[model samples]
Target chain A: MKNGAVLTVNDLRVYYDTPAGTVKAVDGVSFDLRPGERLGLVGESGSGKSTMALALMRMHKPPARIAGGEVLLDGVGDVMELDDEGLRRIRLDRLALVPQGAMNSLNPVMRVRDQLADGIRTHEPGDDRDALTARIRAQLARVGLDADVGGKFPHELSGGMKQRVAIAIGTSLSPSVIIADEPTSALDVVVQRQVMETLRSVQEEIGASVLIVGHDMGLMAQIADRMGVMYAGKLVELAPVHDLFTNPQHPYTRLLIESVPTLMAKRALASIPGAPPTLINVPPGCPFHPRCPSAFEPCDSEVPLPTSQNGRVVSCHLYPGEAA
Target chain B: MTAFLEMTNVSKVFSAGIIRRQHTVAVDDVTMTIDEQSPSILAVAGESGSGKTTLARLLLGVIPPSSGEVIYRGQSVDDLSREQRRTYLREIQPIFQDPFESYNPFYKVDHVLTVPAQKFQLAATKQETTRLIHEALDMVGLQPAETLGRFPHQLSGGQRQRVMVARAMLLRPRLIVADEPVSMVDASLRATILESIRRMKQELGISVVYITHDLTTAYQIADNILVMYKGSVVEAGSVEQVIRDPKHPYTQLLVSSIPQPDPSLPWGAEGEIAGDPESMEVAAVGCKFVDRCPVAFAPCAGQRPPLYHEHPSRAAACFRYDDAPTLEGENLDLVFERQLASQPASGSEEQAAN
Candidate 1:
């Protein structure tokens, strides 16, 4: 049972303090990532997948706080226990994040090389200008960018090129873990494919563990080794990419898979009835029970904890027992 | 014979910039028609800068085409009187990309439904307006109780989008130009919106000009799909024919790029680089796609290839066809593998350390 993954998150709970009530953005979520493995978290907009990723990085401020959880990176210790200096060092050296859009990440005014150099200079303060430039050029190459791209402003580059620069910036320090938040969602389909491909090769090249957050299951199928389904601020199911797509156990997961239309086939899309429940005052019992098809008496009363089944896990009453 | 809706050699150019002005050719010389006999869905699909958005505006008569004429009912759109223009605008409704923008944040959700019903005279009195609103909500499968009186902020994106579709439906427009209507909605709820659009065409007998960048959704509802790239349409045919076997290299890339939810098919890194689609000079003589095309030979850089009819229902614009324009240079083999296409642009990638 001990896979010895580099990062293990257990009982992670992130809640926002709203005037109305506490919004449980990420409640009772747990997952582990092997050192060079890719993990994908897919959910609808308000499913709290992005909040969970932000929580993983301990980026919660006053409004949003990690109420209870333990984020244990193999050598970095519990992220919750980290103080100001620890958080800073760990964030810069141990973890890197590629935010929602690459366009948002880069400083439009600064040269691409300078921006990357800024990343290295913060961590490796002793490195000279030439050394930083060399490192920046090297990182650019790692993300399949040209050396000349160093001098150009962010506006001069295409969206895909800007995205590559974002990747390079994220991976510049050779961080152990990289969290990509919907890297390709804003792009054209063709460009989206190309950006995803770059991320894949870069993941392979650097051998860094990746935790990607996006709503596109089709994209996850291509990018991740394992996939997790998040709904109503809960991690509903976790399985290998192929297994999750082929044999989704949870009713919500099953319906979620059916809802997405794939290019390979044009089977009828069964739209999941109703929108996602609000995290602030989620429905009692199962958050998904209101929209769940196989809602029995139990599903409407008691919350289902994630139960392991067939080398994977799902949080639903359907799979109540342990794996056979 | 006059077609029901005709766009004859339509082209739109914009000259912008202050110090250094640059002309942008958003739509090239494109001719298309939707027949009156068959009320089928015409999907104009392409990536950004493909001019699908401009074409939608032109169709809606929001902007006049720089050269071409848009004819409706055997009359030029330009020649239509002010009264006729209003009627034309009502008949050819448009569904914008963002649903939230369609409705004002200040107004109640049902207010959008009321204005259209009242303006178009679908209802006589207050009671009749409410009835029409309820009926419109029913058509799009929205509960009137839950949707009515709620502000735009309260309604979910899918619900807001549905309300927009319902609003457009109440008018009973002959043709609806839905430009990326489902793009903002969640994936789980996308089918419902697409289904609603399909039902409008099939059950209501309204034609649709569905403009989108997503091809799978296009395939699901579109009767005819038009593939556009860099301000020009490269391929046009039935969904089954064009998607099954794409003739143009750009169409092939767009088709192959669709991320089908299958783990077996790996995301290949090497693909065509869609280089600055916006920066391509407006006056360039050669094929616009030659820059990113995988099978670009000598002749492709000289002249634009005419649209070659591959079948009665399908056509493609490429030099690979047998009816290619004669050139001084020899015509090479028309073969382009996606993997090889990515190579031409990447020029010796720098090696990464372990």
Candidate 2:
């Protein structure tokens, strides 16, 4: 792992083996997660944002496999090289995942308290029932739920409540890195705001680095300190949230930022001219060049590596510099 | 002037539970209208379970209202004769949220367009039908050559939705009831879909009732806005008035909750938290939003607040607007007329000439 980073991903590539060919879902993505920092990954449906989140926690199922990458954790060794027992040992205690679809994440038959206790018991089996109960109450309280909520089943909770319970379970052991995949996708804006608030507060209390993955740029701008834009399975631009919104560098990033409608102003939304290329067989050179407005000669023939200058990293021919 | 379509005191109640038969008011007493002479977009903005879909169903005559009438050209929809009903279906089209579900996987994409043309007898022969299909597809900005021979699964979500827009355009409907058209689409593609819908108003001079939970898109494209909450119209006015300066407490909560793309202006500190979803059971006697409303007072708990006409062009169903006169039967139409008149023309007249 890097000196001060909590998690360092190097050349991470996750691919799905289909009948036709290998679908490169997460292609050559690299980034570092600072402790207590919130980094958000924004992308469209087929952009591989969710796939990267699952692959980071090594939770991707069959057909989807991590091709080659180094997911190095602080104190812990390389996550990609970890065996079954080693991966299981470090999963919830050192790293956790709050998956998508909170409505279906929890067990329907189990009580909220029991679902929480399962994670705790798996890690620390020696804890007594009273201690577990106390810990469960504290976890529920931290997520702004009442102690009585522990006895209720998953079906009894609302969409926002289910998400809160999911967060409580994820942060129960105080993991160093927490990956939240579209934690507020199905929620209404009002409930979304409340749930995000709860997630942020709980993350702060635990001092865990959050890697939130979603498509909503507005929601990402609110919660994420640093933002990464993904297109065609590649991390095209990574910059601080403010700079990314204010002065987006990559053409795709700029188009995405301009596409979002705002309440304060009304302007013609800049729709990207073309759709994202299929990842099954990505076009050579830059994947975003086809849709990019300022497509030069090099953009069609040569891939622009991530160029870092002034704490901003953008992959585009317009910014010529040493690759990060 | 006669309205193109109007819902007068419309309310729909669904009785669930076979044994107990609990009646859920899916859509409460609400009245809105679209003028035939002036083509515009009316965005019905609200959260889930806010009766946005039920309202769309009511507009499209997919479901019958329990109390009031859906009047089309001064005639009740329920009392329309067979020929009039057929004409009504041909004139008022619907664009649903999920484009994938709307298509049959077994048939080619052309099947969606061709079947409607045959049903409505839009063209006399197959050659004329194909020509009409090509023209419709071109209207929505899809290349007919690329989209015609493909199945629903072959096209991208954005393309499928545009095809659906093209399908809606084939009949040349006077009003298009688009229920959350872009909710299931990708963020990058949302603008294109919305742009096509806007073009329906501009190029074709068709009025649209765009139902969605997204306020930003509503603000971007809609001329007038109706903010729904718990099956009731909490606020209704020009999009500029309702979104920029919300009157109802629930509308304020909704507006504030929307996270702007700009990071400099972060969301404000959490105010009064919304009540839990289980506590969202509607009260039959009082304001539906009273339980979650931050400014709820004594009057809010007594009787349902009427749509108080706060301005010539705006109305909100809240006690905060108690100083304004309560809108009676014909006042809603008057206020809506003013609302439409206040906005600049959306270029529909010039484009309609083309």
Candidate 3:
């Protein structure tokens, strides 16, 4: 909390109380966001990447609950301690969320400009309407959308255009922190590149800390300054973008990197065996042990603690001499 | 050499509205061949409305082409009888884009694999059917026991996609029309599905028509590549030859537009490559890509270039290659230069200087 970090989460745990049992979506995960830095949260489906983002924003529903965590937003105090009113105040003005599948997030009947205006009016009351409108127009332009799109309904715009509008809405308030969940997944390759670039440039322009949750490593590699690789409900590796891609430490991280298709490497793609374990009843010991090619006896019996090496933190027994 | 599946001038047009005033040319005059021996992975690459999906559907005989003919095993697809059509379907299977949509959500994942076995009567008993399902599942890297009873939602996106691949493999089809098969799966799991397709092609001699907008994945898995723009093939060749040295301007743009994984390299900010939506709305005599073609000449706006032979195993629809004495004589540098010239003076000069 005292450091220059924009956001810091410590010993975070989020669970879902399903009919099956208590599902540990995010268990004992921790990471930090520096001011104006872009941190990518990457994992396969059900890797707790999205869950971590939701928990940080305290957006989980009745069935899904944050078991324990300390989400400290710099200058604003702990996010977990905030009530509904405090959370609402923090949402648009301080921390903005670009939800996943935002193409469908907009109301079909409402004009996009009105939606943005409504969001602003609800959060920052009695603000200059014209000034806010001008800001919205600039934001839309920044994301490669024209100002005329503000008058159109959600259904009138293409998927890519809608996503850009979503970005415009999220960044309209100039929040201190922005959490974008799978922002480019629904877009085509060309639009995907455009949207990611826009998101990165916009974040830089605003000087706001950004958290991107997605499964696409290539897209993440393009924007992320640092990246966190999650498996099941734990943070397996957290390192600079280059380090994660070039010299990944965790077995899961290595596997994930290897599995990504790129123009440079044309070798036979290797898939990690078995699917991700269900959160309802995650496997004991190391969550990734079942799929980890290098997993040994200790991996099935003991959980590895995150150990730091050269500014990178890795939670794996593969890093020898690292304590659990 | 006689190809296994050959589509000649195949086109599909769908009409909407009460007056039928609007027409969508989903597939337009596409001609390609899948050879018999040493079958290659042919990728029909394009964005939405590029007709790649419609072309796949046409090739699979799910929806017949409105014009021209699809030849399967030396016979026209339309000429086949009911029994012959069934046989053709058995030989040529389709792997849809969404695995979740491919199967009923209520049914277990194994049901998809089991139906083919039952229909083909390949299994004498329930045990044999189960065995066949397991074998197919194993081929696609899915454990039979783990996936058998699970619903679509129960399995992860990767697992569900693998199951769909298993279903496709159950019939032992000689050709697969995989329409953006891995697009929906997680990026970490996409390579695995692609690898399965590659393995199926190598081991089982199954030819795959991989339809996708992702040029990177196309480069990874395809042997032969087809670059489509507005329902027509602009370029076609060996993946290595085409991707490494793209002949057509459209292909070049696509290849360059692919975002490099290296962060050091600048994101190629060649202004938005705008395809003429209006051109696709109405049939035209000229090239479909003329508006977007940076190297478009006067002739490009007047006449649609034919898919002429470029090399021993390559063909492209570009005026640049038309006058070359030999396909190798075609000047790639000159095309790139012409393209640079066609761009607005300010941006091109700045880009060139950079």
Candidate 4:
């Protein structure tokens, strides 16, 4: 909290209480979010990136339960310890989440302006209505939306615009930390850039730490200050953006980097051989062991301890005997 | 010197809305050739509604072009008879963008692989179908037994995409129309899907028409590149020439628009303002990219540029390179001034309307 780390999650585990069995969606994940910093949480589907993001906001439904660990917000106590009312206050005023498929996140029946006003009214009851309207308009403009767009219905705006509006509404409360889950996945290249730029600008304007959960490494590299590479249900590598891309230590991280098609590089990309393990029945050893090219005997039997290498923490057997 | 597939002035128009009054031009006057012996991957690179998907659909003969024709093996795709169409389908196949949507979520992953074998009668028995499915799965780096029983939802995006590729390969098609095939897969798994297709081209001598907006992947896999902007081929050439040494203003803009993985480079310095979405629906004259084109000249407003041959392998539809008489120096500047004046005062309004 002293270092502008707005949110600190340690050994956080979230599992789905499904009828079949408990699905370990997120397991033993630890990370810190510095104020105004952008952290890109990257992994394929079922790697538990989305689940972890949802768990941070404490927004999971009945079937999903936070199994263990702590999520600390600056100036606020443990998130899990908070009662329903305490969580509600934190949700609207301190933490905002831009969920996945934001195209549908908006209230389809409500006008865009009314939606923003509704959020403001619900969160800040005593705030002046005129002031709220003006603020919403300004926020919309900040995200590159027209002031008139507030009057239009959700279906009236394009996918990119709808997403921008969602961002505008999400940041209206001026939260300390914002979690955006795959915000630009459905957007085309040009629109994708615009949406990403909006997110970057919004974060800058509000000075909020942004956690972007996505699978696009190239896009993540463009915006993220630091990145945490998740595989299966575990965090494999966490490093500064440049270090993660250029000098990855984890076998899984290397595979991720190598798999990205770069403009300058011409070598045949080596796609990691196997699929991500099922979260319900994860492999016993390193979650990524089945797909790791350099995996050996210990990799399949014992979970690799997280070790620090060149300013980055990588959980891999490759970085054995290093400082944890 | 016969081309494997040649698209001559192909255009596709779709009617939208309840009354079906709106005409959406998906592919517009796009003409290119894929040579038989060249063994090169042709990238049809553009964003959604840039007509890349329509062009892919046209090539696959899944949908007939509204105008013009696609020639396959020196025969027109539109004119193919029943048996000929079947042969054409055998020669050309498609790899869809969303692997999850490509298969029935309820069915097992191997079901997609076995369908083509059964359709083409490549496997007369269950055992042969099983064997072929295993071989195809192995080629895509999947263990047959492991993938055989898994549902689409159970597998990751990467695995499902590979299964789609394997299904395409089962037909042993000479050409593949991959429409943003890896866009949905994870960045870590994209190279694998791309490599599988590249391997198909190399090992089986299949030509690939890769449609994508990602220049990075296009640079890696495409031997030749075609940059489409608003239903037109703005530039077409060898991948190195088009990507490294682009000629058209549109092509240059697109190549530069790609954010490099390097963090040192400041973001948005090379960024192009998003195009007016309404412009796609308009019946544009001159150049479709005139509004966004930095180097657009006067002739770019009044008259459309033809695809001018620069080198034997390269062609571009830009007044700067074309031999059109109206494209003189001062005139270009005058045209640029007029266009700037004619553009809507509020750029954001254009986006809002869309």
Which candidate should be chosen as best, given TM-score against the real structure?
2
Candidate 4: count the clashes: 0
Model 3: native contacts recovered, as a fraction: 0.50
Off by over 4 Å in 4: A1-4, A308-311, A318-324, B1-4, B17-20, B105-110, B123-134, B149-155, B266-271, B274-283, B323-354
Please give, for residues A189-303, the per-residue lDDT of candidate 2 as tens digits. Answer: 8888989999999999989999999999999999999999999999999999999999999989998988888887887876888788888878889998888889889988898
Every candidate's lDDT: 0.82, 0.88, 0.79, 0.79
Residue B12 C-alpha lDDT in model 2: 94
Q: lDDT (0-100) at residue B348 of candidate 3?
A: 38
lDDT of 3 by residue, B185-290 (tens): 8766787899899877766666788999988899899877788888777777777777888888878777766667656655555664665322335337788787
Candidate 4 reference-contact recovery: 0.66
**TM-score list, all predictions:** 0.93, 0.96, 0.89, 0.89
Considering only chain B, report the TM-score of model 2: 0.93
Q: Candidate 2, what DockQ?
A: 0.76
TM-score for predicted model 2 compared with the true structure: 0.96
lDDT of 4 by residue, A1-324 (tens): 645679999889999887788888888888889878999999988889998998898987768899999999999979989999899899957999987777779899999999889878998888787888888889789898889999999988888888898898889989999999999888766677778888998889889999999888778889999999998878889999998888888888887777777677688786777667777788888988887778899988998888876668888887785855
Per-residue lDDT of model 1, residues A208-290, tens digit only: 89999999888999889899999988999999999998888988889988888766666666799888887887999999999
TM-score of chain B of each: 0.87, 0.93, 0.86, 0.85
Residue-by-residue lDDT tens digits, candidate 3, A1-324: 756898989889999888889988899998889999999988878888888888888987768898998999988888999998999889978899888877678988999889888887887777686888886687778887779988999987877778878888888888999999999787766667667777888888999999999887777777889999888889888999988888888988887777767777678877777677878777788988888888898998888888888879999887754432
Q: Is the docking of candidate 3 incorrect, acceptable, medium or high quality?
A: acceptable
Scored against the native two-chain complex, candidate 1 gets a DockQ of 0.58
Model 3 regions more than 4 Å off: A127-132, A320-324, B1-3, B124-131, B145-154, B269-285, B295-297, B325-354
True contacts kept of each: 0.71, 0.79, 0.50, 0.66
Colliding pairs, model 1: none
